[model samples]
Target chain A: MTITVDRKIYSDKCISNAIYWLSEKYIIERKLDGDIETISVNDDNGENFRTEFLRRLNDFKLREIIETETKDIKTILYAKAFGDFEE
Target chain B: MKKYALLPFNFTQIDGKDVLINELGDMIIAEEGTAQKIVNRTLNDEELYKTLVAKFFISEQLLPPLIDIYAARLRMKKGFMDDKTALHIFVLTLRCNQNCTYCQATSREENAAKCSMSIDDMVNAVKLMFKSPSKHLTMEFQGGEPSLEYELIKTGITKAEEINVAEKRKITYVLCTNCRNLSDELLQLCLKYNVQISTSLDGPDFIHNQNRGKADSYQKTIAGIAKARKILGNDAVAALMTTSELSLNYPKEIVDEYIKQGFNGMFLRALNPYGLASENENWQKYNDRFIAFYKTALDYIIELNKHGTFFREEYATIILRKILTPYTTGFVDLQSPAGIVNSVLIYNYDGYVYASDESRMLAEKGNFTFRLGKISDKYEDIVSGKKVRKISEIWSNEVLAGCSNCVVRVYCGADPVRNHSTQGDMYGFRPTSFFCKKIRQ
Candidate 1:
């Protein structure tokens, strides 16, 4: 199954992460052409891989958003916790 | 309702309540739709809002007033890593007397020649252990049966005792054995050095005997436990159970068996994907059933506690300690940074240093991916080598993809060895991981 996702909607990192996870169960081959990223999956489970792939892709996209929004705060929290500062 | 910024939290539905866990692992059980309201900026309940803010789940003001204090608490939660590795596992030998069906360690026959650790390697491993700056050190002797090599055990401890006269670190010794061969000499050595015995007892006679592949295995083990307890004192002997497919069907019976044996608590350990145990091709099914078995056993134990019996499930206690207490547990499996080389290091019988017990088990099957280095290698090089660097990338649940968004991840752990063995990747796919599923449940 080959699915084309809009690269604008899902960044390369999100797509790659989704592919990395799915690669365990599916032989995934990914290619980027302009704004569209085509993912070809050879699933061993013989199930509908497209829906699950898209769902995981969207999940990674949401995760990317959350990570971006919380990155600075997380850094501040961890630094305050583990870093040595002379205040 | 006021607009408030989120402060790195995750939510999950547990027992019909929305459980929100913050970055520092503080949890709040709120009504259903609470998570949706918080995400959509529509949380109007003034009291709940104030509680969330106070708990550092949401920040009404940029940087909560007690941000430093919150950070300090988080730091304290990870205080296990403050000292270097504390739990040092010495794989004494791979020789065993009994043939167990689900033996994960891949033990050899009783007289398997040249599979034991040499005195030279033991000395070097002890030296490597002292290099770790942990104020308290645990020298855990693991084997097909460490009691089989009583001389090696005595030599290793005697060396540690001699070295500690000046080193003065609080060193604790633990022997992980099958207890079928707890000889008089072994007990005397344990009594001399105060070595704690951790043995296996799957269930009653039928289950234990079948799992051990010896009909009188249960009797021998029971007798061994009694002898060890009599010599080392009752508190010094601890027993753990491995829940195989057969053991799963008898959860209540197993709990009852432990209570019958006069044990106050027991760890309902699931089978790890390693060695002969990994050959069981029905991991998914086993995992599902194991969860059910665990819950049933835990409920029964809780009932016993309610009925004035002091029996507790050790695994649930570890999770509860993380959920209910402000302090972190010393359980290596359930820690962020994966606990591999961070909290424990394995000195295998083959004169190599591996990441953990499972890492060495992987070596038994010809996978040396987690083998840090030889015992003779520099401590700095072994701990900070290329492989360790690669493992570090995915050892933290806070940064992992699926784990970052999990409400239970704060209470759970990151397992790279299990991930690598089961998923073929150090950074495991939690959506497809049985470990993630079981822990989340």
Candidate 2:
């Protein structure tokens, strides 16, 4: 099974994390060619593997967006809770 | 949302609805597009808007007026860290009377020599337990069968009591025994010291005997429980069950057995990858089956609750308490910073200290990854050693890759021991993590 994901649509972190989950069951090989990243895994029968991988990919993409937007607030929140900072 | 800023939060799709959880574990179930709308600042629901603000999910200003309160709640949630290590387990010995098919304790024959903690080691371990700054301390005794080594259990508690007189710390004593042969002398000691008894009972006679590897094991255990209840109060004795491959087939039967035995609830614990239990042929299939078994039992327990039976599923209660209440659960497995050194420590019979009970089981197989130090070592050195520091780096779920942005991160915890045992690494791959799959469900 081959999956080609455009670098413009998803970050490396998202794609890698999505693949990390599937690496346990499949022999996944990842290669980079310019802006396109191709991932190959041991073939499953049909649409199940692609569907599951795409679902996880989409979830990670959403998570990357959330992390990018709220990284600063999260730091501030944790610091406020644990750090000895002046109010 | 009208001119609002997002507070750090995460969401997951549950039952086709976006369930958003804030940093402090406060949750809001809203429409599917709620997360994108919140990020885009296009939320229009007034009720949800008020809820989001009230729950610390969103801020009307750069910093909410109640930011201090929010910070306080966050601090309170991680309050277990302030308590240091509260539950100290003492492994009395590895000797056992009954042979369990899926024994995690790595039990040996009753005559197994050089496996029991020495009297001097017991004294040293008790002394070491008092070093923790936790105000309330629980000294839990476990083994292949702790009751088999009556003298060690007596010495450990007596030593702890002797120290507590001057130390002035609140203390609790627990005996993790099989109840197969809880002798009269042991019951007398338990009665004298107010020791709480924790035992394991798989299910009805057939199931219990099959798992226990003894035909009369169930009878002896039931009789022992009756004697213990007669001596110690009913509330002082509790039973826990592990979902074995055979046990999964009869979830309702298991619950029914617990209720019949007069137990108010049961902990539907899963078998971990340690000791004899690690020989499981297929873990993923077993995990999937266990989850289904857990849900069936939980639903039956809930139905019983609705019908005036005061029974509860202990695991569900812990998870629900995190979601519905404003307090933290004392359960070690569900804590965010991970409960290893922060919540529980094990004093093994080998005169060594371990991070947790499972750590010692791993040691039985020559894996010393979690062995902290010797019983004679200074408390500071044992807890603050380089090994502990390395574990602390990845202890919190808030920092783990897959867990950091998880919707249930506030309620879930990290288990580096499980990670190391199952996945051969402390930084576990989360997507295929059995722990993740089980807890998330």
Candidate 3:
């Protein structure tokens, strides 16, 4: 699951959507965000990826903060959960 | 106005690419749902007005959707050229002694036996370079090691002088080297030829030696900088560099070393995710760590700058230049691929000519390929051929998705080579690429 969250709206939105599309094919966990906030996900895999993604993905430019945000998150999480859009 | 006649679009399948493989087995990754998504969303639009939208996107033509035909005609005007800029890369030599891991130069101890360019070849290449719409030329050199073949250094100046004398064309020269073999002779040549020296220093001794390879790597490079500074004077020996695994932890150390060595600033570069290094597992550190590395280093440099530290960041300078200046060189990486072409060309040791050294580096490692002309052949055939036009289309064409909608498109340049490496296309949606994201930060 990839969670790409960049304020670079148009282009990144497309990438964000693509991650969702991939979700239909695999057990993917994805999310995109505006500003990165430390979230405590109750799911086991959720915390696993969050640690990796946050550790690697911040490049200061909003444009770059999303790609690694996708990959590192994908490696551990379950299901495609996008945005901070809560349950 | 149909360009297909001049240069046809050959939609070959990307080779061996599970998504789209062509005849030669080159890979091209294309998603399944994109075309359908486009079709589904736009199928029910009010009317067939895409031609108007297409014109708007490419030419900034009248806002066809905003009003009726009368208003559009009033708004229509002569279109501005939105093509990629000219880049003139002057390759000084294809000879290098060291065997670094990601050396796309294909240089080594064995390659040293080969001869570099004759003065005549250089003179012709320079003259041919000036034939583009680019008025200003960025004369950058790379090697084997540029210093190995010293005569070409003098010849580059002599040729530039000859052309500059007649055409009065402005040409800026940059020499890329390791500075290991840096000598008084080379420094003198640079001073004489008016070439600014750009060299690499990965980090401090142990790490740099591990990355650059060679026992004397640190001592020799530092010593060479001393000699380079003597001739070029202060700030003449520019530190243009690469980032590797060893360098990730040592950004502060790298900055400190650069200052100690008299480099006024630095470009805390990221390693290219390609070449010999591409296959190696050791070089692949977490991208997050890279971000962290940059954060620490950049903070340090910024602090240095805020306190009136004379240091400036070259990459930051390039970004700032694009942001602050009306005219940007836009080298596609840092350059606007859609602006005027600068008059620099890369002639590899084996006689292949590419638009830039980075292009050759990408091609040699097997992707984003373009050959302008072989030195053995006339420039007419290569430059006029379909491949050159194909590449030029990839560079200047405004039809790409990221580039089209990108507000930063004005400031950010696209590297087809980098894109091809990651996404297997000349125009990968850069705003979406991991490498672009890392660098854009």
Candidate 4:
């Protein structure tokens, strides 16, 4: 199974995470060429590797969106927790 | 779209409803597409809007007026930090009578040589335990069978009691045993010291016996429970169940068995990857099956509750306590700061301190990544050592990659030991984590 994921849409970290998770069930090999990353799977379990990979990829993208949105608020929250605001 | 700032919240779809969980473990379940609307800033439902605003899910103003209150409540949820290492586990020995197949501790035969904690080690461990400034401490004895070592149990308790006279800390004692060897002397000691008994009962006779690899295991365990309850009162004895592969097919049977044994609650614990149990090659399948089994058992328990049985699934209760209530749970496994050395510590039979029970189990397999220090080491040096300091880095869900943006991070915990054991790293990759999958479900 071969699936090409675009780096512009999904970050390399997200793709790496998806591959790491899927690597448990499928023997996955990745090739990166500029903005495109191709993942090859050797799945003997007859599982739909492409579907699972895409689903997790989308999930990671959603997480990235949430992380990007909440980054500042999280920073402020932690700053208030461990920082000396009075000084 | 109104310019409403986002508070720290995550959203997930469950039962066709969009569930929004905030940083303080507050949650709101809305109709489907609610999360899409929330992310798109198109939410128009007045009641939902009010809920989002009130629960610190969203801020209408530049900053929510309750930012300070939110931070304070968040701090309060982690109040276990103020009470450092309340649960102290004392591994008495690795020797046991019965040979359980799925035993996580990898118990040895009754006469296993040199696996027991020495008196010097126990005395030093007890002294080290008092170094923690926690006003309330619980000394829990664990083993292949702690009942076999009645002397160590007595010695540890007596030492704690002797120290308490001067230190004036409230202390509680717990004995985790298989219940097959709860002798009269052991029961008498338990009675004198007010030691609570925690025994394992997987299910009915067939399942329990099969798991224990003994024909009379269930019968003897039941007899032991009866004896302990009679001697120490029913309230002093508690039972926990570990879900094995075979137990997955009999969820209702397991719940019914607990109820029949007069237990009002059962902790539907998953099989941890350690010891002989880790030798099982089908962890992914086991995890999936266990999740299904947990839901089935929980449903049966709830049905029993509806029928006036008052039975509760303890793991769900801990998660629910975080989700539905404002208070934090004392459950070490499901706490932030990883709960290894923060809320619990283990003094093993080999005179070494471990981060948690699972940490000690890793040591049983010759991996000492989570070994804190020797029992003789100073408490400050052990907890604040170089290794512990490194572990502390990834102990918070607030900072981890996948955990940070998780809608359920508030309800979940950071487990560095589990991460290190399962993923070969302290900072776990949540995408592939079975722990994350089970908890999210």
Candidate 5:
């Protein structure tokens, strides 16, 4: 699914801090050790737009970016660690 | 005026394709307890701006000379590793009846020239263990399956008991076994030796048998646990660990399995990617998923406690202790991937000993340098060896950019050996590290 990330995900204490927030918005999952993963957003005939975890933010630089951003997305981070990866 | 709070801070940086922690030092200008309260409290927009600006100014403002004094002073007061040597794990044997995918130690092949410890080797190792100033010396026996050499253990305990009495030292004996071979005879002997049982039972029958395929491992283990409790008569027997494929699917079922077996506690363990058997398993760890799993499972256990189930998740308990208390028993799990740890020494099936059981497994692939000393060698060789000291130091500092600023750095631990084995790099510097991903959560 095409999802957008706020630059705040890169602020200091931002990467891990995003764990609590992001999980609420997307599913949290991992593949082997250093690989980045993303998934397709799905909907039954009516579910519309909601899906499991979008994808793991792969770049370490991206992780740092998520950690360094100062903005707080208190919108309870979405996450659903359910289902298999959609390739 | 530019000022940086000598408060604890971790500075993470991304370079090239990896992340490196430029710095990590928590200096509390305030007294001890004060730092814990404000730590990890995610800074707000204004606060974040101020912190970054202050750090930037300090980099540009302070002369290098003053920062050095401040850094050194913080290290002295907070001395991260309190007891130089806290736990002494001796691999009694490496023979197993089960085929677990995450068995970090190699199985003791019956034809692989297996040799049980002699009375002398046990006595020497026990004597060496007492040399450290740690008041309570805990000697834990681990293995591919330690119970295989019951004779050596019984004799070794007699010697350790003799030495501890002679030296006026206190020691606790712990055994990490598979319980499949736990017999009535073994239980009686374990009781006689005052050895607390630490066995493994990963989930229920289907999931457990698939990961650890011993013909009657389930029934034998359940019966063994019953016998162990009958012999010990109380909360004496405990479960050891192993993570598996089935565990990933049903975190709750695993917890229920532990509860059903009436395990004293269940350690949600990590799969060692390295090992003779596990190398080809290609198991993956989901950091974010595991974190959620940990929290959910632990919170479930807590809920069970309210219903009078009285259960504890070992991983969460240890982490909670680190967060809630001062100075833990120094379980290696709590130390950061960058933290230093004089490893648990592994005395293989034969007379040879290595820095850790994992080291011995590496030898199968022709990496022979793992042998730190012989069971017949001086105890000083293992404890004070240059190689052990050097390798241990590699993890003692925060080298990962993400962990540098991790407020939870003190609570998380890094495994250099795992990173080195899996990534082919002794030092992994990103939060993406399997070790970091799990521990940080």
Candidate 6:
């Protein structure tokens, strides 16, 4: 099964993390053709890897959004908690 | 809604509700799409808006007026790191009498030579333990059978006592032993130093004997427990049980066994993947069964609690404490920064220091991946060395890929030893991690 994930929607890191998870069960292959990233799962066992892959892809994308938005705030919070802060 | 700034928080869907958890583990359960509403600034509920602001999920000002209080609470959550290696486990000896079916310690026979800790090395380990800056210190003795080496245990305690005259640290002594031979002298030493007895009792006679690999093992252990209780008082002794393959089928029976033995609580510890126990072929199936077994046992315990009987499940209590309170637990397994050198260290019989108890078990299998340094080495070099620097990278789940965004990250921890032992790396892959699966479930 082959799925094309748009790089604009999901970054390469998100796709790679999703693949790292599913790679345990399936022989996954990936190719980058410009903005569209094509992912192929060599699952001859008839298992529906696409659903699991898409679920993880969406979850990672959500996580990526959260991390990108909150990275600076988290840094400030941690710094205030542990690091020497100039008030 | 008024314009508001977001404080760092994460959300996940559970029971058709959006459960939002803040940086300090404070949670709010709301209707579906609540997280999207909050993120999109479309939330219209005035009460929820107020609640979110009060819980540090959102800031009415660009910087929350109480940001210092929020940082203090966050600091308290990770305060175990500041305590700095409070629990020092001394592996007295590896000699054993009964062979456990799932012996993770890799115990040697009773007559095995060179398996016990030497006095010189033990004294050095005790001195090293005193060097820790923690005000409260726990010196726990563990072994194939710690009671078997009575003199070594005595020496270790006496050395600590002697040093504490000036150090004046509050020290706790725990003897982790199989109660097969809690002799009168040993019980006397325990009573003198106020040492707590922590012994193993797998279950009822049939289950315990089977796991202990002896026909008369249960009888000896029960008698020993009675003797220890008679000498040391009931409250001073605590028993723990490990869930073996056979033990999983009898969760209720196990709980009943603890009640029958007059224990107020039971710790339902699963068999770890180390030593002889690692020989089990199917950990995935075993982990699933263990989870079901834990739930069944926990439900039974809760039912007992509701029926005018007070019983506690220790593991659940730890989780509940994390969820319900702002304080940190002494449980090393459930600490951020991975508990290795932060909260506990192992002084092994092999004259080497290790990261944790499980690290010493890995050593029994000829894997010294966690061997920090020799007992004779300086404490600073051992704890702050290059290996520890590498481990520090992935010790906290807050920075890990899967766990950072997890709803339960606040209630969970990172375990580098478990990762290295099971996943071949210190930074574990959480998607299929058994630890992640069990804890998240």
Largest lDDT belongs to which candidate? 6
Q: State the lDDT of candidate 4 residue by residue for B288-367, as single tens digits.
A: 99988888888888888898879889998888888888888888888887788998999999999999999999999999
User: TM-scores, in order shown?
Assistant: 0.90, 0.95, 0.65, 0.90, 0.67, 0.95
TM-score of 4: 0.90
Q: What is the lDDT, from 0 to 100, of the residue B430 in candidate 4?
A: 83
Question: Over the true interface residues, superposed, what is the Cα RMSD of model 2?
Answer: 1.9
lDDT of 1 by residue, B406-439 (tens): 6688888899999999999888888789998888
**Ranking of all predicted structures according to DockQ, beginning with the best and ending with the worst:** 2, 6, 1, 4, 5, 3
Worst 10 residues of 3 chain B by lDDT: B3-12
- What are the runs in model 6 whose C-alpha is more than 4 Å off? A44-48, A85-87
State how far residue B137 of model 2 sits from its true place (Å). 0.8
lDDT of 5 by residue, B1-441 (tens): 233322223333223221121123222232222222222333334543354434321232323334544343333323334345546777666566677655667665633444455567776677667765666667788776777777767766777788777677667888887776776777777788688888778778877777776667777778877877888865878875565655667778888988777665788875666574456444444445556666777778788889988777777777666544443435664564322235355555556666655666776456655577777677677666876676665564355545444645655666666566666766654544666666644
Give the Å shift of residue B20 in candidate 6.
1.9
| Model 3, span B1-441: residue lDDT tens | 211100000111124321321111112233442222222233233222243233221112222132233222211210112221245565655567676765656555625555467677777777666665455666777776887777777777777788788777667777788887776777777787677777888777877787767888878888887788777886677776677776787888888888877678788777666556566464335566777887898889999988887887776776665444334334445544433223245665556677666666666566537556676566666565677667666764234654533334444554565666666777776534766566445
DockQ of each: 0.33, 0.51, 0.02, 0.33, 0.03, 0.46
Could you tell me the lDDT of residue B193 within candidate 3? Answer: 64
Each model's total of backbone clashes: 0, 1, 40, 0, 43, 0
TM-score of model 5 (first chain only): 0.22
Candidate 2: docking tier = medium
Docking class of 4: acceptable
* Per-residue lDDT of model 2, residues B52-143, tens digit only: 98898888887788878888888888878777799999999999998999999899998989999999999999999999999999999999
lDDT by residue (B1-441, candidate 6, tens digit) is: 899888878777778998888889898999988877887789999999999999988888877788788888998888887788899999999999989999999999988999999999999999999989899999999998999999999999999999999999999999998899888899999999999999999999999999999999999998988998999999998999999999999999999989998999999999998989888999989999999999999999999999988899999999988877898887889888788999999999999999999999999999998999999999998899898888888899878977776779989999999988888888888877889889888
The DockQ score of candidate 3 comes to 0.02
Report each candidate's C-alpha RMSD, comma-separated, in the order given: 3.5, 2.2, 15.2, 3.3, 12.3, 2.1
Worst 10 residues of 1 chain B by lDDT: B5-14
Error of 6 at B237 (Å): 0.8
